[model samples]
Target: MKNFALFLVVCFLWSCNKDDQVETYTYTLGIPETMTKVEWRSQVAVQAPKPIASVGKIYAYQNYIFINEKHKGVHVIDNSDPTAPQVVSYINIPGNEDISIKNDFLYADNAIDLVVFDISNINLIHEVERLEDVFNYYSDYQMPAEVQAADYSNFDADSQVIVGWRVEERTEIVNYNESFFSDNSLATNTVGTGGSLARFQIVNDFLYTVGSFELKTFDISNLSQPNLVNTNTAGWNIETMFHADGFLYLGGSNGMFINSIANPAAPEYVSMFTHWDGCDPVVVDGDYAYLTLRGGNACGQELSTLEVIDISDKSNPTLVAQHALDSPYGLGFKGNDLFVCDGASGLKIYDKTNPLDLQLLHVFSDVQATDVIPLEDRLLMISDAALYQYNYDDQNNIVLLSTFNLN
Candidate 1:
């Protein structure tokens, strides 16, 4: 009887403890009275600059690539293969904007001087000579009736008569006087002036450099020293010059100018293709010319568009297609495709397979793309304070592959 009473007492104490632990606690479900959540956020992915990286834009050679940075020198990339590019060396050049290569020589602009580099070696690039004697090549002014005579235009008779509102057409309606300047003293004169070298080209035995107010020609049969041959006043704000087919093309704030270089010592104005405002960044292949219009500084008008023209007939270039874009600065061609360095939209690709019907193929964003050149089969190099490689995939698509930041 005593053992049974002890067991009952232990069971009663355990049940009481379990009941005390099972008691519920009170709580409230409502908004917090002390604070509120802030719902704002930011979005901007930035990458820090790396050492030994390319600085500005990039130019391509058969075996290597050249990249330009603002204050740093040019970076050379080994491109034995398209997909995998590695840096080889850095060629020190300050204030460089762009580069062009021909016959183992490299040409670059230092804003104040037109520089020529000895690039015979893919491993080392050295500055050989600089010409600061360019004068009267370019300006930011309107083309006079005498100068505009060589440009093609579609202006109505009334438009030409309108004083301030007329779109000064660029193309000349009449054929140039072929016999007028053959015996002129100006054809064989040597004139030197202090001008900016905006664009240059070497065709045949002649070297052409576009200056602030005139197009200057030199005899380059002697490669080491270029002798001034002749100069012709072309246009204002001259942006770029190119030789295609049998003609030489000039880009200006005014429009596109075409001249026959069949006689290099005496190039005659053939025609002009007019854009709404200023046309810049010209690239050409065969019968087609690609250009960008970055609008005007004056308030009355501005143009933001890409223009493709057909120059089969040198004296009457025709506009085939146009596409609107942001501040465009550079143009490049690979096969039948066109690449534009649109200021804000990055690098844009288009199919010029049908020059008359240009189609947008792809775009790589955030590049601030200023210039583009093909590297090989499916890769390209872009410039924007550094050199970048972009690749096209099996699906015929484009993607940013690598970046080399030059700081």
Candidate 2:
């Protein structure tokens, strides 16, 4: 009778313990892929054309189109003939996401370093100089939530570089009070034209860049030798920048910042215009700044809109109008035609003759547009899957010239 009572007591305790525990739930984590710092720094090559696996920013100089392959390198294409662009060469730049060209010199961000290349001979490009430790974007090394803490547990940052991620699903029991974790996946240039999504912009002799929340200036006054001249805290969550009439317009996650580049080498903050939190890329024409706030993906909020801000008074910018958009990404103006690469909703063309009431002209929903460059002769658009060229000469009937496979 004593043994039976002991067994019952043990069973009851076990039941209570199990009832108090939380159930298991499966979630995915991104495991970081790393390499030795030495190897990453020395890995720069210009070789035969390889298929582009990803798109970061698109830049056009003379007749060549340079497309960034996320954290890998850049794919150089001969766009002399927009009807059919060929992937002529690939510049192997580890952790490259932006590029700009001036006087045949191609400037790019290689990890935390600023690397300059002589691309005068498109087929024979070589590294000319490199400025080391100019950026503090360790955020690039930071993996998405939950997984990031795990990243610190497994990786050593002192001697390694994170180039990519390997996703893995895991199941773990959690208490009722424990919150669920989620992963957030985290140019210029030039004398050449950049898509509105470009962070690197070349204004005359100075090259300016916005990363995270800082503005970095590079004095490329000398075509061959570039110098890091200044660094200023410009805005919060800055995404892209535009230069117009000696002023720099910075688009951030929370607002628009205006800085006067009258000094060129160093920028002075002028004013700010706050907006809904989202990922925005800005472009300016005359006195108005056009911003496309995209909400989704890693961009905060679930609202997408096209906002026009009157910057005639740079110090006190106010909203002109806000129009709903499907998922606006990169945008630019070809004459008075405002072309927006609306994700999923395709190419949205508008008559911006009136900024207050942007007259919607067309929405080409056939393509999943992300970023675009309104070149002098044609329009170059990069989607999730391909590079598309269109002849916007006939505003009434914009024609697709060709589509290059980006897969």
Candidate 3:
């Protein structure tokens, strides 16, 4: 009888413990695809300056600065006074990704088309010409909700372009694992320099743009109308392009390729310096090429590093020095100072007078910087939420000139 009573007590305690435990469940919402591209060529209209949100590449020309608003448009900001910049106007171009200025013309990519705009008067910006169906293969838009997978079957290149995305909610259980993550020329009127993250660059009269696996060239000898000259096979996962002297440096996920642009219209491959798979952006100074490789997402690795390569001989480039970094993104140089955008670690400035031993000068930890442009008189740093301008002195001291927030 005593053994039976003890067994009953143990059973009762187990039942009580089971009842005390709470059950947890995850609920997900289904998001259906709703965004479609309209005929933006006919819908081009100048809107008043709106709030800045998704910022991409930035280009400065004369006293005006053009900031890309992701796929929406370009925001024109007058920075005549570095201390206080003003948003003069906004040019609405659907599916716009990058911008470059030469003389009075602004070149931008709109979905599959290369659109040229007359930016002589920021308020009166108008599309001068559209070269249709240039970039046909690009990543598609992804929905935010967790339930349904993106369906691109309806996306027809002949009639439509994936310009943007829209979200609609429905209650459903989504599989947790499946997730999809996805311009310009100028002349005699000098072409404005772009950030290291830029993929579109203008060399003399030819406009070069690097896609994932090809380099498309356009003869922009005529500013208003750009002609498609040729498309050459670049390499796998080409992320950015930098032009110097008579050569083109193509930064790919797998390697750095140097091409001789002796024939600006047809770039010939000279050499390739291979590296581990990662997203890389490169900038060249003198005989050295500096590349920052950060691994994450589609980059196929988890290593972050800054590599200094000796390109004294373009055909036989050699890696001279390397330094590990904390998720470095875009980098640029001014004089002997190199600025690296170290993702969440902010902006890291290094004195690269000695490329073998790059000395850390300063780290601005306030913002999550992604790219930088070291111009003649000031420094422009781009973060996820803001654009920062700073002035550097001989003592290596950097003073904040102004900040334009895109919240």
lDDT of 3 by residue, 161-254 (tens): 5554553342332222432111011011111111222278998798898876788899999999999998988877688899888989999888
In model 1, which runs have C-alpha deviations exceeding 4 angstroms? 1-57, 69-77, 80-99, 108-115, 122-197, 296-300, 375-379, 392-395
- Model 2 CA deviation exceeding 4 Å by range: 1-33, 145-159, 164-198
Instruction: Compute each candidate's TM-score over C-alphas.
Output: 0.62, 0.83, 0.80
Query: Per-residue error at 32 for model 1, in Å?
Result: 65
Q: Which candidate number has the best TM-score?
A: 2
For all candidates in order, the CA lDDT equals 0.58, 0.79, 0.75
Using lDDT as the measure, the top candidate is: 2
Better of 2 and 3 by lDDT: 2
Model 2 residue 184 CA deviation (Å) reads 23
TM-score order, best first, reads: 2, 3, 1
TM-score winner between candidates 1 and 2: 2
lDDT of 3: 0.75
